[model samples]
Target: MSKHLFSASLLLAISLVVGKSAWGDDNAQSPEPMPPQLEATIKAFEAIGGMHEYRECYGFPSLKFHFFGLKLDSTDADIKKMPVVPFPFAFTSISNSITDLGVAELAKQKNMRALNLVDAQISGQGLAELTHVKDLEVLNLSNSSIQDKGLEALSNFPQLRALRLGNTEVTDDCFVYVSRLKDLEALDLRFTQVQGKKLNELKPCEKLQQLLFSGCPVTDERLQELGKREALEGLDLDYTQVTDNGTKTLENFPNLRNLSLSATKIADQGLEDVGKQKRLQRLYLSGTRVTDEGMSHLGGLDQLEELALSETKVQDAGLAKLSDLKNLNNLKLIRTQVTGTGFDAFSDVPLQTLNLSHAPISDSGMKAIAQIKTLKELTLDHVPLSDEGAKQLASLDNLTLLSLGHSNIGEEGLKSVSQMSKLRVLDLSDTPVSDDSIKELAKLKELRLLYLSGSVITKDSIAQLKKALPNCDIQSDSK
Candidate 1:
């Protein structure tokens, strides 16, 4: 689905660095010649209209694809008569192009494996055409109108491993078909008409490791069905009605590493079980009822790397229990009751990214975490800090991103933040900083994104800043 397969992307990024001059190594003796087969593929891609040239990285040969823009008479019938492109991947803005005849023609290319028709007008009849694609593995039909009967066509895809039907019109009746895909490993049913009890149909999907039901209308009883699954590794039940009892169902996942319970009704009763998941590496509990009592249960999660407890009832005492999690590198505590001594918890850890936005952190509270020399990104949005507290951030040499939005931090206080030469993204929106402080940010040559909304900067000032940092994306609330 990406430019290349997941393993291929990784290979290109880190592993494929020794062989070719494409790796861009300075001491290369000769330029590696492209293979004839690969050259033919490139020629085929160029033969198609609106194709972009490939760029190599990390010595990995770039994938070749074609793009055809606004074809004046593009239609489903028009696409049916069109010939298969020279390459396996392509992007075309053909209106109503997922019709049965068009799909039949596209399926003739046995080499094609990944296709994206997101937000297309494909209906039941049109979707049935996908049954012909035996080798297609990744299919994205998000935001389509494909319904129950149409879903039946996908049950037989031999190589279909990843399917996305999020925001579709199908309900439990459609899930009955989804259950038949035993080979399915990743499934996203978010924002759909799918509801309770019928979700138990997923238990039969033995190979399913990643399931996202965010924004689905599911109850505790229905979600508990997941307790029977042992292969699940990533589960997102965010914005569901699942309570502590439903959270217990996740205990069935022995290999569970990534779980999101954000905006649920889970509290201390469930955290005791969550704390026992020794293999957990990432957990999100934002917008839940977790309190200090629940925080005590999580002290044993030494393997945890990323944890989000934002918008909950966790205070200073609760946060103190998480200080020893040396593996924790990312923490989000937005709008929580954590403040004052709560800030003391993170000073001992090597935190690289922290979000304390919408909390009540004062100058002294801000100083507590300044000792966290490893902090690379920090968000103190709406946590009003005085000028002295703002200056404490200057000691953090690794700070690359800083957001002080609505902190009431004035231009004088911003003088200290302006000294963070390594900062690439800065959010000073909704603050009292004016032109004087705004101009100081221009000195940061590496700054790429600057948010100036709700500040006193004018359109002319933004224009000048844009000119100074021609490549930076500087946004202001001029409108």
Candidate 2:
């Protein structure tokens, strides 16, 4: 049973035994029983591995249920029992099991604020059932069987703010219905057949701030049509046919804050145009041709907070250019050419999260990284960290999570790791650590989780270490 259900049952048991209400008022009368419809709805939802909990919705506490990737095998009798609830529910990836009948059951939720049917088996006709949900603000039908015919139901939702139709059968013909949603603020058409021309129909959506066409065949000609949307705050064109020429359209969106062009043909010249978006806070350039030259263009984005340059040609020299990004906190440089030589440039940047996995960072790089005292979580998986290099990490006193899996750290390094008294989670998996390191590992009394998997540590040593740190969840494999 779920924790919520168990607590409810326990509360009922206490109420009966003490002759008091569940709210702990002895003199107060018992609360009214749940209505039959509500009870049946709860049972129908729970039968499909759905879980509900009270969460703050708007200002007041409201019940919310979530069903993800679960096969909805509830019988027709159970479906009939699924009545309307004055709450929201998410049915994501409940593939092919939920048909028009299931959607009709969900349609009874007239007050639902958000509905997610991503990758569901519902058809366009099935979506018509949700037309009665007048207050619905968010609707996601991405990767479903929904087509243009089903989108006609969208016109009924005047309060709709965010709509995701990515990877669906909907073509440009669907935008005619989508354009009717004047309140729509976000629209996602990723991996869909809709080209850029039909997006012009969304001119009615003046509140539209976010538009995504990632993995679509959006070309420069079609993308240029969207240049008029100066109010756009976020736009994604990852894996599109857009090139450097298409990047020129970015200059039109002065308010763009979050932009992604990952896996596109955009290069340094395109980045030069991207650099002009001074207000950009989060930028993704992974799996592109971005090099050190392109990195120079991002130096002016002082408001940048998160940057993804993984699987790119970025090197240590490029790090110096990003030092000006004072707000940069989360940076992913996985599979990059960075050796950590220019890490000192961020020593004063207040960076808290850094991932350098699979990078050939040397001992000098580790020393440079140690200078950045603000890091709280660091990932160096599959990196070449020598004993001395690993010892340098002890300087990061604030580090709570550290992943050094598949690294070259040894017994000497394990001794230095024990010095991180504030570390709550540590990953030394697939390393050369052995039973001899148990003495040092036991010193981490504050550790909540420790991973020693794929190490040569014996089962007996792990037991001994566990005895010293009873609260720590130690995971290891016996030699």
Candidate 3:
């Protein structure tokens, strides 16, 4: 009885397989084993294939990969047919692969340029396969099980320019392997085990341009070592363990243009050190120990274009230091205790953009800011500005953007700003401005964006405003 049952089960299985072959599934054969040609295409991506289908192959001068809605380990047959190409194409990207395609196998592809194997089950062996792609320029292996050994595979690529190893197991040992790429330009090591020791390993890439080591455990000394490279353009040291002592290292990199030290333990003294970098264009010091005293250091940076001091201890007293930045353009002071007195600091400066949203600046503060004849963009969200205060913004003859969202400005107050002929963007969302006040804005032919959502403006009033400014976008509550 047992033998008969076994035989019957075996026959049933054979019948199902034969039936599937004869009839086919959806008129197509199930994915079969990878063919030799397709296997070779995977090995030699550049010469045999193009970018992932979604990616524009040949769009850039470097590399390309066609990645379209593909998940890792979707099917082995799909992986074998992946495309590879150089830049100047369209729609190319990198995506996660579930299973590890051993590094040796990846390296076999002589032409593969763009590889997006992020969050794939890549191990040390899989990473090693990447060493063989001598022509690879862009490799994104983010969120993989990569360690120092995995990084070792990258040492073989002499032409690699952009590499993203964010959220990997890279350490000092990994940097040793990374330093070998003499032509490396951009390196993103965010959220990794690399510290100061890694800087020593990165010294080989003297031409390196951008370095993002955010959330690393490195000391200030390591940053100093990396700063020695004059070609370093942008550096993001956010959430690092570096302190004021570490900030001293940054003085070595005089060519840096963009710097982010947010959440670092650096105090006013460290900011003073950073202020000495005359080439600094964009600086971010949010959530740092910087105070009003540090504001003096930043005031002297003539090249500074944009600066952020949100949530810092700096008050109105410190704002006076910034009045000297003649080239200053953009400033953000969100969530700071800066009062109307801080507006005095911009009395002499020609600010183009200012974000004081959530600051306790009323009509009096707006009057002080209006003195900035060149002011183009201004935000007064949640301020105590009434009709009288809202009218004070009319002094800005060249003002193109005025955001009074959630303010006490009503329909009468908006009429005061109607005289701003150059005003292009007006955001009055959540204000008490009614339809009657909006009618006054229709005369401004230069208006581009008009937001009156949540206001008492009726549909007929919105239509009146839209009819007048046919080219403008009127976003009303009714919409």
- CA lDDT, every model vs. true structure: 0.69, 0.75, 0.68
lDDT of 1 at 356: 88
Please give, for residues 1-479, the per-residue lDDT of candidate 3 as tens digits.
Answer: 11112232233232222111100111222223333454443344443334323221221111122222122343334445545422221112243544555334444456665566667667666656565576766666778777777666776677777777889887767777778889887777889987866476676788787788889987876776664778877787888988999878886687877788888898998987898888887888888989998888887789887788877888888988888888888887876777657767676676887877777776666677767888887777777776777777778889877787887887677677888999877777787777577567877888877777788878888888888999787777674
What TM-scores do the predictions have?
0.81, 0.85, 0.74
> Once superposed on the true structure, which residue ranges of model 3 sit more than 4 Å away at CA?
1-91, 94-133, 143-147, 221-227, 343-348, 458-464, 474-479
CA deviation > 4 Å runs, candidate 1: 1-105, 458-473, 477-479
Residue-level lDDT for 220 in candidate 3: 72
Candidate 1 C-alpha lDDT tens digits along 1-479? 11111222233243222212111132212224433455555454454432322322211111111222112134455555444444433333334445555555556555555555666677666656656666666566778767878878786476666677778887878778888887777777777876766777776688887777888888878876565677777777888888888767766788777788899989999998888888787888989999988987888888888899998989888888888888898888888867656757676677898888888876777778787889988888888788888888888879877887778887667778878889877777777877777577787777777778888887877888888888677767764
Q: Judging by TM-score against the true structure, name the best candidate.
A: 2
Please report, as a residue range, the 10-residue window in candidate 3 with the lowest summed lDDT. 17-26
Q: Model 2 clash pairs?
A: none
lDDT of 2 by residue, 391-473 (tens): 99889999887888888899999888889989877888888988889899888888877778888989999889999999877
Candidate 3 — what's its lDDT? Answer: 0.68
Candidate number with greatest lDDT: 2
TM-score for candidate 3, please give it: 0.74
lDDT of 3 at 85: 29
Worst 10 residues of 2 by lDDT: 56-65
